[model samples]
Target: MLTFFALVHQEDDSAYGVQFPDVAGCFSAADDMEQVIRNASEALALHLEDGDLPAPRSLAEIKKDEDVAAELAHGAFLIAVPLISFTGRSKKANITMDAGLLQAIDDTASARDLTRSAYLASLARRDISG
Candidate 1:
């Protein structure tokens, strides 16, 4: 997973605002702190879905910018947002696992009307993003 840094700002009576310094035109807002990471992750995924992804800079690099410095001085903060990319392609993989665990996974996937692969992918995405 690749991660990008987001600059977050909030006023006394408004929702929290977020912007990706490395990704132009990508932004998100959340009503509270709990939503910040999730909302930012979704916004970043959508923004890059149809475009080339930009290289993410480090915190030290972003902090060096004069504009970012000013923002930080004015109560803005930074957060790391993880990016999960999907290429719309699949490849075969062979793995060894305990038979009991495999059976449980298959049964749960069947109950949810999802394939084993899809269920595993969803779990990975949720864990990585949150």
Candidate 2:
């Protein structure tokens, strides 16, 4: 898991706009505040899908940037956006849980057309990001 600092801008009567300073050219937009993080995460994932991603800069470093400083001066704000990598490799693990609970998880996953591991991973990502 990695996290990026996204600068958000909202002009009068306009949608919220997000741009990742660490990942150049990566951005997203949303009409509602609640969608900003989710949309930004998706944009970051797509933007990083191809090659090696550069290391994320620290907040202090980003804040020191002249461009970022200018944006901050104009009312833009920052938000932390979590990046989850889908490695496409499977790993096996052993855990103990109540049999009924396990069965329920499996049933729910099946209903959603996802494997148990995928369902659990999604839940973990959401919890961690939130």
Candidate 3:
């Protein structure tokens, strides 16, 4: 699933309501900030599951919350939330292999009736996790 950053602002003087601009119809609020954050998580989860928002960022985006919130006081607080990027992480890691590693991979793939890439991927899962 993808995630997206949103600028949720208070829409009224009472500050009881919040609205996510980047996300249409995505509004979550509570009597307090704690509840608001929890509700926002649920709302964000639903929004992402519904595939309404864009892909989220791996790294947190820079935003000015206090100033933006003041600017949007008539609405909701302008918050910079770290969203889950559906595209996943972009960082790369280096791995070492022997000269005959490719040949061994081919042999394993053929034995399992799988592609070399698939075999390697499974190997990676096992090696990394188990």
Query: How well does each candidate superpose onto the true structure, as a TM-score?
Result: 0.76, 0.79, 0.40
Q: Residues 1-130, candidate 3: write the lDDT tens digits.
A: 2334455544445444545545667776667555555556556656666475554433233134454446456543445443432343444556578859878888989999998767876665334321
Candidate 2 on 48-81: residue-level lDDT in tens?
Answer: 9886888988899989988888999999998888
Candidate 1 lDDT over 15-123, as tens digits, reads 9999999999999999998889888998999999999989999989999988889999999999999997767898777878999999999999999999999888887
lDDT of each: 0.91, 0.88, 0.54
In model 1, the number of clashes is 0
lDDT of 2: 0.88
Clashing pairs in 1: none
Over 4 Å off, model 1: 11-15, 31-35
* Overall local distance difference test of candidate 1: 0.91
RMSD of 3: 12.1
Between candidates 1 and 3, which one is better according to TM-score? 1
* Model 1: lDDT of residue 103: 98
Per-residue lDDT value at 53 in model 2? 89
Clash count per candidate: 0, 0, 7
User: Regarding TM-score, does 2 or 3 come out ahead?
Assistant: 2
